[model samples]
Target: MKKKNKSKWLVPVLGLALLAPTVLPTSASATPAKKVTSVEFVGMPAPATAQDMARVYSGASVKVTYDDGTIKSFPLTYKTLFKSTDVINGTPAGVAVDVHGKPIMDRSVPDKPVPFVSDDPDSNSLMKIDGAKPTGLGGNPLSLITHYEYITSDQSGKSAYGIIPASMSLSTIDQNKATGELSVTDVKKVDFSSVGGLWIPCNGSLTPWNTHLSSEEYDADARAYEADPAQTYVSSFTKNYYQDDKKVGNPYAYGYIPEVTVHADHRATVVKHYSMGRFSHELGRVAPDRRTVFFGDDGSNTMMFLYVADKAEDLSAGTLYAAKWIQTSDENGGTANLKWIKLGHATDNEVKAYIDKGIKFSDIFEAADHDTPGFTKIKTYPSGKLEWLKVKPGMEKAAAFLESRRYGAIMGATAEFNKMEGVAVNSKDKKLYVAMSYVEKSMEKDIKGTDASDDIQVKKIKAGVTYEISLEGHQQDKDNNKINSEFVPSLMKGLIVGEDLPKADEKGNTAVVDKVANPDNLSYSESMRTLFIGEDSGMHANNFVWAYNVDTKKLSRILSLPAGAEATGLQSVDHYNGFSYIMSNLQHPGDEMIIPEPLKTEVEGYINQNFDNKRSGLVGYISGLPSLEIKKWKNTNKPDVTLQVAAKANGAKVTWNNKEHTVTVEKGVNKMVLKVGERFVEINGETFELPSEIRVKKGRTTLPADLLDSFFR
Candidate 1:
């Protein structure tokens, strides 16, 4: 990585007020939110008392007793957010409530904890509302607050763990956008025991039956720790279908299970589904028909995969498939076709074969004192209705079979396949999008001859290009946003404009049309499928959110993201207004800095560097800096993310600092026109000075770090 050095300054934490807060709303709102169907208490931090943390967490349900005498149950899940001495106890319990007041029950051990159990006085988890916040309304009703963690395994035996948590907020976020702040508390820790296991951030899809289809993303070497039934750290979460009637503890009604470790001895909350292929998955989404599920493997050499649950509802027993893009080059403008390849049979025998080949069973057998031997027998899988694929007649059956055979080779998949990350469906559009990273393509170019005299020589020309896929109307919602549109092929034609496409100068006087879509006028097939490609590495290494147009058999809009940003997950929800949430790890261009290792030293240095004024505004113009510009910056573009900011001044002087980037607009007098060679910026009329040199890059420009220097000074 080329280290870019620039000035970095820290702003007062108070500046965080500039960002909007994220509040999850309840189903009663204009947009009905996804109801909280269930809740489970995972490993809780050691509580101060010996009482099982699960008991307090699972049983608690808060009720708001409004002044009107109307009572509403608040969804709450008590869990250890962080094991910190900050609280008197090692296990500090924080309540995570689904603001939407979705019901919760234990799926694994069902037939016990029933709804309305909140009314029971014996429950430790019920929240009794004594009074509302003082707005002069003593008995007025208020909303409940909860928290949850986005966690994953280290996969590397190194023990380091990453945990991302959203800031605590009342569920009514839309209403609180003005005063509420959407912040993410992040912590990366390294410890012991849980080391080396693959971390699973299972972004499960909503099944037709309203259950989640959660899949596992395991590390390849996870089996090294196991002796027999070689486990590679894959876990599954299935709906156990059991409803707990007793007000005892957990009311999941359905529970998630870690089946890969063969730790079956440890009673699992749920069973594993071997039918879904094992890999490092970020998220998975099922097709409308609910028969086909598309998933992406995270990390290098990731490949797009699909699992055709023989029985859509019964994903436990089904054949898995991988998508293979048919590479082609012809006058019809080189085409890419997705071919489905079967991974394994739905039978338990096939699953056992994977185990025999070093997949561990002990990972699922929690009771095993030590690792055991590999077991290979279809007998291990429970007999159940297995889902199968329904292939169309006159289709490329041979090609599909051939592709399946090739993908079935796990070893080959590791060696030959590239990483395919981020699979999403635009529910409204009925299109699916998959993202690939660091993909290279050749761009034809013509060079002049070396002869100085006369003849212009043509040089052999080929340039490598990396791009994302944009499939029109493939991943659409039930209502149909793009797929159902009357403007079909023609609208799709102009979707993806090449990078070199001509654009007039800043003046917009000239027409620059370099290249057009490789294959224009693409029409969707009956099965409008799509994929999104997110590149993690390479030169011009950008994380692109590309969509594939299955109908036209070509890529459509190629959303080029800032360098180093990865679009890891996607969710198109009608619940959160009309917005498609794109979860990304894009480094924010502002709010960054470099401090010395020693806490005292870095602080002293930072203070001295700005002469006691640590703000960026104090520093004078640093020259030779490259300006960062974002042509398409939008708050809705990135949902559920913490923004970082970076910048540069004149003369290409650069600073790669990390500052809290705010999306909230600042209060200002008015807007004005830009003069020739003039830069635009906001300043506190009372305390700030104009930066000596500020240049705005066309489209989107990186806010200068000196803005802080100029103000703080």
Candidate 2:
């Protein structure tokens, strides 16, 4: 009877017999080996204990066992073993093991997981182990660029200049919001003639012809006085004081009024358009038709607006309209606002009538405080009753929503807030997102006086996702049906907007009105819903860039820059071949990235707020290139371990250390002098340079090897 199984195991003998065919067929040599594909690790936490097993055993041999009783082993490290986990708390919280016991990861987590060694010897590559290479591209080390000071310093070969103190008085620097002055000395002094005075922080887009369109974020008092048809003499801030007399047409012209500057063909052209409804503009998103453009004014009381150009030649003569929020009752019996305002045709007489009533000529920031002394809302009594009033052409439909204390502090007049900032469109999804930086004054809360005084507002924006214009509006195919665009929604998803809506008053005292942000409240700010408010005081001030989603009436906060850093100009690097850059600047002396006291704390506070919390599928606010191949390398098999080495004349100098065998290189060139402790080697005259792998095995070290040495040498 099956040789009378000698011993009975914890599992049934009958069951074991049944499982033998599937489990016991392989011999020791029948198993396949485990081959490591990649390795990765982060310096977040050290091994908790010897048994933690998370320790990185890179370059350690891994083996796998196969059904044929065979085994294979290969060297592997941290990255290949597991993918990076970006989310702080989510599925596969820290590290997740694959079928073969490897890990996959999410990227939002502040700390990365450590890699573990495979103590077992049965692993090998033929087992079909898969993993990502150690890319070193995902958020390895966080870097921030602030406190800009431009200077010119001379260096050999490449043109170099010392970054020094220089201030630009333009409205927007680099096409972004007005950030304080930082030093960026990349300008060749001789190129001054090509420079436009406006220094928009960010979000400046290139025109169809590749020119920079910088928005006038604010009404420069000096520029208003000089450029106005009826001019009064009021001076604005000036830089390079001595040159004031030398510049033409109010050196200020180059600085104020949103204008377009063309950079191609070697000629600089600047054109300012005053018809686009002045406000704190963050973007000018031209429609696919290229005739209609949408923009958001960043301010406490902002205006979501659109411009329909009257003539293709004169974009400056577009009809401007302010967006109005229309309220609707939701399934929960709660009210929601879902529509924006568009200006229809209003007769010149009607427009003049409102203009005479003190409709202040201003942008988003100014509109928020239309009640201020100099700010006039241009109150008009329609010929008919409020309910019977007609929505005229060239006139925007008024939004039913109003400002609330918990939103944002009123900056100037403090009447109503319209601070809408970042705007982005996803053509595939046909969605748009608007970022609003709403500011509410202090003293709105009921906290203690001391607390109120200590209270500094924190600011941030929201990515308001809305559907793009329907394809039906575009020219139809012969079938007369809309053509589907191949645009898909980006990975960015739901972002909490105004979640930290203010609760305290200016004196740090808690107030009843502060409760307006909650759904349970009946406060005026809570009742109205057209606009999604974002904090613009503390850290919120620095956020830029908003992307939209078409399907969900939700907005995702896709990216952010340093506070006060506007997204002046943005170009998604061509997925094909090209480098994209983001340019930004502050306007005042020493205004660069300086987070004073409460503000500084606010920035850190914003980042650390969710230190231990994790949101599923949250896209990070990353700037610069999403990924880069900064260096490259190639290798070949050689006959001897010590091959004839010669450094090619690529102008690169090579060096290394043999002690710890660690050496870093600064420049890449053809020939070079190298030293290791007391050892020296002239690589120029050799037939082939030493291979890095062999060098490393020989205990030789090199820094930036890919940049300094060519493996083909």
Candidate 3:
């Protein structure tokens, strides 16, 4: 069944099912019943005894038999997970790694740089070496990592480098193949001259062609300045650093999506696609066809956009359309019909020509109202306020492409989405998922009367939600409506909802549950058929990354960030050396106490009052399997007998004591002992039965091949 609303909480069931066998009856005759040897489970629980089954973890698995004599089980294994570190060794000149292992200061930061003030280091993309597989950078398949840095600092002030709000950088990680350890070697600033600058580069996606598609958020006013240079600066942060651009009249160059292509040799090239309509872009998801693109506008009362390119993988020339929401009875649950309203179409060069000609973009909207021949208005249902401007003149057409959001508003696109963050496509199911950080009744405010004001009245708010849009049979809509040729918008339904945490107790203690608040970035793993969701919320004490199983409808908390931190860039990798891995980022953690001048005193006072100072912003990987080491018995008599050991966070070291006749498996300070030729192991003098007896081969003691299964679980 579907969930009721975005704020509905999903309480996970915390018990594990007991292992049971299925008995199958013979035919109708009085024959003996046959026993089925299999069992099935939703998620594989940790290896536990009968007493521990009832309190198994949420993601833990269990085995059960159905009445029909069918059995099933999920893959259950521990993995080596990485957490944010406070130290990044070997800092190069001009670059200083923070306690979180993040490169906070790159080459662009002048010597004796101004006090660094930044927040929200979002988006994590890994560019691997040529012919390298996805076994992670530490494995032989992939040995190097190309890391991208996003500084979501929209503060206004002077620094040693110059006045700047937002910036981007690049770094490299050298991995030791033998130890599976990572180290940051070099960090450098990325030149964005081709795109003016990077503004609020948030959660991004790795394209199928192996390129990075970084999105620009909160730059809607670029079009306003391009239309009329007299308009007051929309943002003080950009105004202080980009004053020179305002003087040169190039505000239109900053809002479009930028693409970064990292070569095999580690060099990179950045380009901005002007053809992709400019707005407060959050995420850009390219379809498997490589021509259809879906993007979200991250703000209250914003529009959902679609772009269709003329050629495959070419976004430089395309036709943009905006979605109109048709609400049904289940609107609150994110179920609604959608229709695409054609905004305009143009090439990057064609739109740039109009900007170069000093033509005000606002004039094109004015020209749409005139009784010009061949200019027609496209109608929107209910409120015909949103009518498309059929621009006959070429310049007017150019305006539609340049100022896309403004054109979409005039064309009646629904502005009800609140913080539309990430967009991801599930290629296997042909479904699209969009993350709405949170929804409020104020998002339904009508913008017809106050077109100039960007703020929408806030009345009631709900928690964050993820909407699933079905793309099946969408192509048929082109034939259903001749005017909507080649453009068909599909319906949206809520897939998952986030909830808030309860207040702490008198002692300031709170329960640690698998709850998420603001869902920001989304990613789909084709191999595992799961959706990875990241959070960017201030409402929760700590943000978390959740993994939702599509087929089983089970949501599990995979990772959690530190205090005052948000999770970003939840991506799944399937192309690396036949192994699967997840890449995620923790942005703007609340651990560091460094602050700028004026705010330093205030921040310090607040910290002293609160007595809390913990910050960590890092990029790391999550592997699918635990670290394992296998050694086989040398004697031929010991067929199928071998030694196997696995560790979760690090490799387990095996130590043998010939005189004591004991085999010790050690990871960190935790150790377990198995006596030679024994059928049970000892942990702190507590005995546990093993699956098989230990053995010896070539003067070396060995355990059964699967003896360590319980150790890792």
Candidate 4:
């Protein structure tokens, strides 16, 4: 990996460059230093004894109090479940062959985690395992269940579907399940070569029928032109995938949800659901009734959508609808009334027929002006303009089904939902939880407007918030054709929003880390009544997985990842071998080293070279550097006391004296002075001792950064 020299400063510390002065007799000094009784040094505050340091450091148990005054404690442990490299080696031989008939090389995995555990209703009956104490297909009293891993790809050359069967086994199953441990085992990958090349496969739902419903996120508009060379209405964002004469097949063949069913024989079959409508699908959440499904779009300024199937078990035929937001109030956290606007209805065959004809998917909706009989104008909401497509005569009604987002916008659906992510349903309260990684002010518009002009200016700081929409008292239309219920949506919870938290430096930037921000994938466990939230956030240095209690509105940190890593596919699983599991993916960790020994020299050099004069900034701020510590100067003779920095801001201040070649640390009226190149310090003119002499390297001063915490206390 190539290294980039991004930052100029090395690290934060306090140091001074001093020149040697002519020697003077002890009694001949001009001004005599006054001696005082005692001296106190100002230093950083220490963490209270009550703080749970162990919980944050190791996989120890911690209790979190919710906003509603409810309490729940659990031991936090994050196991690597599986890595991308593991899946490559785990694939059965002769299963996947490349374009040249050679075995496909190992590929990287993306962020989709779908489980097929023994306790899952669909997998239980299919695998002939008792749901109560289910075992794996291998029958070793299965501790870990089967799960599917979806790999998103920008390259068309790699395989997108890989499965890890029985990745982890539970060591024990008991009432204290959270305390139970899991032992990982070698698992093989089940390849889905029949699905063809999948592009940007994202999050999806575990279907009511016990199958995996994975989504295809990005679609190339250029694919539409390839299907119909005469097409004129293609979106400008489409990429020309066939430019290099790559025979990678049709682009229109991708972008829909591929339902995969893994049989007891360990073979899998994938079927793309054209009827579910194609867009940048984030994921789908199936309703308990099985007919209605909620889907989130993972693009900027996108729409929230749903599909109603003709049958409870099948998704091959359905009517798609987009949410229309009706602002009830102007407050940021106020409730908004939601109504669903019908886009269109079509079966998989009918949609395929339109694609077979000369009808490009983009031709279904009016992207720009100048076309006759363009999209029909629909009722407008404050969010944006709404219109429905005017399907050309003799054209199959599948245009709306293929370009679902465009059709939904034309039908008066609100497209202001910024990055609509994971969707989960609360079976007990009949509420749907929608995770919007970014909630913009524009989504709160109350008046109708045209799609041509922009009304709401995007804000600089965007925080992740979860909305709770009540689905109570839903009633069908008189014709029994559509549901005519108003969805009242209120801000259920907000992450990383407050005055104390740092804001993003620029609009849409993700540099600042608040308490919690950018909540992504969500999974709700009915039995535990807890919602597991995984983060795909750039705002935080280390992304974390959180557990929130729906009833009590309490949230707690369950797991965290290293730098540049994201917590993906967080889900609450059923008890197995006496343990309940929360499965998640730690994606793409950064190069930051976690161990101390190898980094000791590098860290010490950084502190000596880069300790800036500015004191109030993040650099040299004790709280900012969580891993800072003090150590003995290399090859130092004297040894006694050392300074340590604390976490609080009101710590001690150290001053460097250039003329006298000395260092002084002060806390209010008290002071301690240490001469340059000496191991002893004078406390209020009284001799004091130190563990080592003040060291200097490369013309810069050095000291143990953390040892200052002791004097302040």
Sliding window of 10 residues with minimal summed lDDT for model 4? 614-623
The backbone clash count of each candidate, in order, is: 152, 148, 19, 25
Go through the candidates in order and give the C-alpha RMSD of each one to the true structure: 22.5, 22.5, 12.7, 19.8
Better of 1 and 2 by TM-score: 2
The candidate maximizing TM-score is 3
lDDT of 2 by residue, 1-713 (tens): 22222221111110000111111111211122222221111112211221221111122222322233333222222211111123222322122222222332222233653321111010000000012121132211111111111111112212111111121111101111111111111111101222333332223443443334445443323223333722421121122212243422232232222444322222234455545543444556554545556565544333445556665434655444443332232111112232223233222234333323433222112232223454323211110011111122333311111111111111111212234444544443344444433323220221444221212222322222121222223322223432222221112222323344244333221222111111100000011111122222332333323222222333323223333222322233121111112222111111123344554454444433322111111111112211111011222332332222322243334455456443333232223333443122222211112333324435534322332323223
Worst lDDT run of 10 residues, candidate 1, spans: 117-126
TM-score of each: 0.35, 0.40, 0.66, 0.58
Whole-model Cα lDDT of every candidate shown, in order: 0.26, 0.26, 0.52, 0.45
lDDT of 1 by residue, 524-584 (tens): 1122233323233222222233334433434422233222222222222111111112222
Q: Which ten residues in a row have the lowest lDDT in candidate 2?
A: 120-129
Candidate number with greatest lDDT: 3
Q: After best superposition, candidate 4 residue 47: deviation in angstroms?
A: 14
lDDT of 3: 0.52
Which candidate, 1 or 3, would have the higher TM-score against the true structure?
3
lDDT of 3 by residue, 42-120 (tens): 3332212312211111243324232344332222322212222232233221222332223443234346443233334
Better of 1 and 3 by lDDT: 3
